[model samples]
Target: MQKTSYLKELVIKNTHEKNGANNSKKETEKIQSLLNLFSIANPNSGTGTSIDGDFGPATEKAVKNFQKIKNAAQTGVVNQNLFDLLALPIKKAFEDPIQGSNLRELIVNTAKNHLQNNPFELIIHQQGNSGPWVRSYMDGKEGSDWLWCMGFVQTIIDQASSIQGKNFKSLMPLTYSCDTVGVKGIEKHLLTRYQAARSNPSVIKPGDIFLIQKSNLDWMHTGIVIDVNGDTIETIEGNTNSMGSSNGNAVANKIRNFKTSKIDFFSIAPLV
Candidate 1:
């Protein structure tokens, strides 16, 4: 198949209907392409749909199955959320145990690349900490005043996804609030949280996001996991420093023990 860059041209707002005989061939073809890719990536996920560019019962069934797996509304119609999931890289390396490898390496490398450039030093008070690097990650939505840990993670994922012709924000919630990040993860069924005392280090993988719990109802910090060993995890965090506070001075790498009491829970974004 030729790379047509069709995803960039497709606009998703509400649910897209391609069922019955009323569907357009061009639109159905796009949907078929996505379903074909999805079927290939997730082979054991039941029967595959033919790329005939026709919205038959088989295509609708495949879409419905995908919706069920994603915990989305089983309307059998593709929506913005479903569209985003379909756009993810078929060759995921992080979460899915079946199809791919080295997914964490892609995420960690992207974060490290930003660290090497040291974009935090480019902050200016008048401009509210805006720079080429910062702006690229901000998604045209925020300035420097915003706590940027979420932005930093979002930016890194965005960069990595673009390289694969996918959209990271579409796959996960794009928010600046730590609390909201957790909520979005749960809503999207992509969040996995473990208690500090009961958590197993093996469950934590590189490229996952960890939330620092400040209280029962509040999470004060977040970072990207780069490496996970027995009871210890290394992170590349934004808006942090040597002190390890979420609102610290700059982006830096830090190591922490899984037994830390302050760590309320950690969440993993779906990359499979």
Candidate 2:
């Protein structure tokens, strides 16, 4: 059978239904993964069920809600249609069918597109010069005067993940603080320290994040990696300029030398 078909069969076989037999731990885990992804995509669809591998009333409700959204039968069961909907975004995002092209490549492509388009526009605000794009980084929570470098990076990652029906918060912490991202990386064991990444530059690839360190425990600036070459790295940064600064006026493309720069690198964990 085709891989996708086989996978669908596996999910259906293992799924826990409202009135059906309880699913095995493994089966329930798979279902929970899909539920988590769905919740991230549709926050109000009752799909935000806890991913504890227990297909209880909440999971059933979430399934039913998702079914309604898809215009399918509200069976509250993991059926082929449900599986297909869960997988559609990823399949659509990577339809090019290139071998070994992973989600990171998709993220890099998205960031590159933003850089090429320069979607942000400078506007005078009560706080300072801001724009719609900058506000979007904060999900419209913070104003223009806010330090939004980390928000910009987080927004790009979140947007890219959304395109593939994945959750950015599941992959990385959704924070506006660069230091918070660095701390979360260390706590989650997802961090590649600056010195190590500099010594072994191969670890710094496109879609990775670079944090400009202000002190031993503080990061003042952030950016997304678009390309990495020997000794030099290309980045798309927010609130930066021709001469880079964490509090610069707008988003701009930048190049920095890893060996000579005081930057820490955080490698984003791959989506399951």
Identify the leading candidate in terms of lDDT. 2
Position 30, candidate 1: lDDT: 49
Off by over 4 Å in 2: 1-100, 121-126, 142-144
How many clashing residue pairs appear in each of the predictions shown? 0, 0
TM-score of 1: 0.56
Give the worst 10-residue stretch by lDDT in candidate 2.
1-10
**Model 1, global lDDT:** 0.61
| Candidate 1 lDDT over residue span 1-272, tens digit each | 01222234243444556555456665565466566545544787652676565677888888888888778787778765677677444212212222224556677787776565443413333444343234444543334476768777766666555555566656666677788877776677655555733455566777788887776547888888888776777888887879887765457889988675455334444553
Instruction: Give the lDDT of residue 94 in candidate 2.
Output: 26
Task: Give the range where candidate 1 is weakest over 10 consecutive residues by summed lDDT.
Answer: 91-100
C-alpha lDDT score of every prediction, in listed order = 0.61, 0.67
TM-score of each: 0.56, 0.60
Off by over 4 Å in 1: 1-101, 121-123, 126-132, 140-144, 194-198, 264-269
Candidate 2's residue-wise lDDT over 64-155, tens digit each?
88888888888888855577676554333323222225667866776666554343324333444343345455555435557878877776
